[model samples]
Target: MNYVLYAVPFFFLLIGLELLADRWRKVSTYRLADAINSLSAGVLSTTVGLLTKVVGLLTYTFAWQHWGVFELSAQNLWVWLFAFVFYDFCYYWNHRLGHERNVLWAAHSVHHQSEEYNLSTALRQTSTGWIFGWVFYLPMALVGVPPLVFLTVAALNLLYQFWVHTRHIPKLGWFEWVFISPSNHRVHHAQNAVYMDRNYGGVFIVWDRLFGTFQEELDEEPVVFGVTTPLASWNPLWANLQFYVVLWRDAVLAESWWDKLRIWFMRTGWRPADVAAKYPQSKADLSQFVKFHVPLRPAQQLYAGLQFVLYVAAGSFLLATGANQSVAVLLGSCAWMAFGLYVLGLWLENRPQALGLEVLRLLLNAPALWLAEQAGLLPISTLGWSLLGLYSLASALALVLVARRGSAALPA
Candidate 1:
């Protein structure tokens, strides 16, 4: 089943409901725009993922075909299932290590950069996760999981994660111990000392429970979200690049080359003494103002929740459909989607210039999509029509959004 395409609408529907529920219960603590921006990153990233998968598939088929793993995978579904489960187990380590190591943290920090925690946070994924990120999944290949099942299970695992990002859910009794609940996951997103680098789990919290990385949410000191060095700006590209840029600057600033080299691989919080001394550590307590600024009204809360569900449903559909799609087509579509939404979200949040750019992109994409269909870049199917319609609607909404701002400042 092309589960992802269906998941996209499902995601929007649920997110909309979640938003409305927040308004009713008054539990939300994030802005609608920020949440939407985060989700836009998510939609863009999921679309970007199509390219990575295409590259991965080609490398697996033509290049790695002679390997023993493919042979083993050809015969055994059980092997595929085991590999799928084991891969997630390994993911827990990769995730845990991402928080613990500075180099990995630089890449992983994109997901955590969102100050707001909501369904969109699940969508606030990293575009460059293919770097070193693929390494964690290799064990599945080694153990003979066919590329197809590996991707399907991987997508399913990711799809499972969508609902976990919400703040509307409380701790789920014993489920909290065995699963990644909103409360526990919120602690993982926290930059607070007690919560930092803890609760590394994907579908199952059992890994965190067994690994000693798990930390229960504290009522005494509420979870203060975001990184120690807060990303104050709203630019998506800046969010992605900030840690790398910081790492490079610190490398240059270090008096000794060893300190420069040492810092990037060290624990995430580690900084050279001089850097620490000059910059000082930031421990902004978000708890005080969180209640005042973030909670949503019942209707708006549901609307946001529904919006998220819709993006996920759309993203997942494309992801699953593109899994088997030709590499060239997948890559081309992703190039448009990732860069488009990434910039659009930025325009919506930080800069107005991108609004014009997004307009150009929207204009170009419609004809490009039609041409792609004519050129057989994509199959003309019901699913394709649905995607085209939704994307068109989304793009139109994006343009209207520019006008809605009432900035009246055209591109300079």
Candidate 2:
């Protein structure tokens, strides 16, 4: 059975609940277009997943060969439970390490790039974590957990996390102790000092409770979400890479080699003394911060909301149909990508002009789909891996153009 096929309906359920909550309780968790854009990114990520799995399989099979052991089955329930919990335990460590180590942090930070916390934020997953992510769960197989069980449980764990992304639910008293509740999960998303590096549970919240890394959501200071070194831009790729790129620049600019070595392994945001001394505190005064203007025009909202429904329906179809090779698959992909870029433009408008470069990026990726076709990259494979290096390079240059336009507009 194609488990991911259900993500379409789940996407709709999330959006509908968000809307219903907004009307009934005035707790509007997402703007329509932003939601669509987020959903589109998720669709694109799954499109990317088809490629990543090939890498995952090769790595897993190679490990098994090196150990001279291979066992596969769908008949074991106890092993599934074991792998399920075991993966969460490993994930807790991987996730916790992601917040602590700068290199790991770089790969994981993209998920926290969104300032407006909502269901959309949940869909904002990292694309690069696959590189080291699988290594963390290898112990499950060594313990003899079936591969099918591992895959299924991981999916279930992910599905369980989806509902926690919303702000609609208030704190559940005792439920907060055993399962990852909205309150505890909200604290995990926060950028505040108290909330930082806490709550690393996946399926069960008990892991956090036992690990001494748990932090409660207090009513005093409301959580200010997103990474401390904020991306503050709309380009999803840039969001994924900004921290690592910054860390790299700092490491290269360091006078001593030890400083370079210390940067990646130390706690994230840790800087060398010399490097910190040269360029000191240039903090923006938050009181002077102007709120981003969504404007929320009635017509604009309607347009965005409508686009959200239409593009999601279209993307969902693409996801379900075409079991790897089919003609005209780009139809759903283009509509979805366009929606992503369009909503990104909406949020980008409120940010610094420097952030709008994402528009060019959105424009740049369209050709990869075409190029994939012309090059006969997959023969009959229409859309499994349409956008690759070409698409990314084009998007980067497109963003550069948007940045250039903005720079030119400023008066000397």
**Could you give the C-alpha RMSD of every candidate to the true structure, in order shown?**
5.6, 7.3
**For model 1, what is the C-alpha lDDT against the true structure?**
0.71
The lDDT of model 2 is: 0.66
In order, the Cα lDDT scores of the candidates are 0.71, 0.66
lDDT of 1 by residue, 114-202 (tens): 77788878878877667767666666666556777766787788888888887788788988876778899999998788888888888
Q: Write candidate 2's Cα lDDT for 86-160 as tens digits.
A: 889988998998888888898888777666677777887776778778888776666555556767787888877
Over 4 Å off, model 2: 32-37, 65-73, 281-412
Compared with the true structure, model 2 gives a TM-score of: 0.76
